[model samples]
Target: MLFVTHVVPVNEPGQPRLDREAVWEGLVMKANNALPFVPAMSECEVVERHGDSSFDRAIRIQGDPYRERITLEAPHRVVFTRLSGPILGTIANEIEGDGDDMQLRFSFALVIAGTPGNSQGEEDYAKNMTGMYIAALEGTLDAMRRIAVDNAA
Candidate 1:
């Protein structure tokens, strides 16, 4: 299994300031339809809605299909659990801090279907995954900033 966690400041100097509400909205948007935020995801559709707090979505990443159950914890966190995919585990995006010091934390614990745990291949894969996820986090924040600016206009 590969486990990794990364945290990044939400507010960058000179960028459009995003409040908790805006950030929460962006998270929900990404959960529902990731095509705009996740460059690797070519397609996404809501498969089922488990009420206001949870839902299931089908997404295609790099031409492979997968399903994820997404649970939203209001204005704080969004957790994505892989239900059917090459990799199985949970990935969480959490909002931390208050006011101007807000941060976004991304963490995941995943394993390739047939790969042995703690192997060199797994370690290399984990490193690549970490960099991809960090880029995704930055992209998410950039999308949020754009949304904030558009909303404020």
Candidate 2:
């Protein structure tokens, strides 16, 4: 098992304001057709709901479905998931951020289970996951933020 968490604030502050709906629009609706820095999941689509936001779509990555429940507000939050498939389960993303200052923070976790016939030390298993899944996720978030900042500007 490997656990990695990061908090990166947008360098600028007091972004003035952009409602959650607007930010969600940029992320799901507008971002769908746009190139995403997170390559693990692909082809995001958003249904414009006038009220609380939610959506489901196919993630080309590993051929899974990522359903999301959004708390659309200042720091729009999304609890994205992919259930079923060889991956078993994944927290596609649980993210929140302000459209102003282009600020955002993403937290994620990845666990690789040992096979029935395999025996690996806890430290060793964690190390392997950190090298692969954790590293990939970190890189993806970094790229996503950079692109969001550039685009927001």
Candidate 3:
């Protein structure tokens, strides 16, 4: 299995400061439709709505289709579990700290289906995936900031 976690400070100098509500709203938006936040995703659709806090989405990333069940823990976290995809595991986006000192954390524990655990190939793949996730986190923060600015307007 491949496990990695990355955390980024949500408040940065000169950028629109995003409060917890704004950040949470951005997360919810991304959970429902990731195309605006995830550059690699070509399509996203909510396939099933479990409730106000959970749903299943079908997404195409780089032209490959995948399904994920998303659970939202309101102003705090969003968890995405792979339902049908090459990789199987959970990805979590979390908000840590409070007020002006908040941070965003992204973590995942995933393994390719049919692949041996801890193999060198899997290690290399994990590294690549980590980079992509890092970029995604940055993009997410950027989008959140944009949302905050738009809402303040």
- Please, what is the TM-score per model? 0.97, 0.46, 0.96
lDDT of 3 by residue, 121-153 (tens): 898889888888898899999988888888889
Write down the lDDT of every candidate, Cα atoms only. 0.91, 0.43, 0.90
User: Cα deviation in Å at residue 136, candidate 3?
Assistant: 0.8
Q: What tens-digit string does per-residue lDDT give for candidate 1 at 1-153?
A: 999999988887888888888888999999999887887789899999998999999998778889999999998999999999898899999999976899999999998888899998899889988888888888899889888888888
**Which stretches in model 1 have alpha-carbon errors above 4 Å?**
none
lDDT of 1 at 148: 85
Candidate 2 wrongly placed segments (more than 4 Å)? 1-3, 12-26, 29-35, 42-52, 62-75, 88-103, 109-153
- As a whole number from 0 to 100, the lDDT of residue 44 in candidate 2 is 57
Give the worst 10-residue stretch by lDDT in candidate 1: 34-43
- What's model 1's TM-score? 0.97
lDDT of 3: 0.90
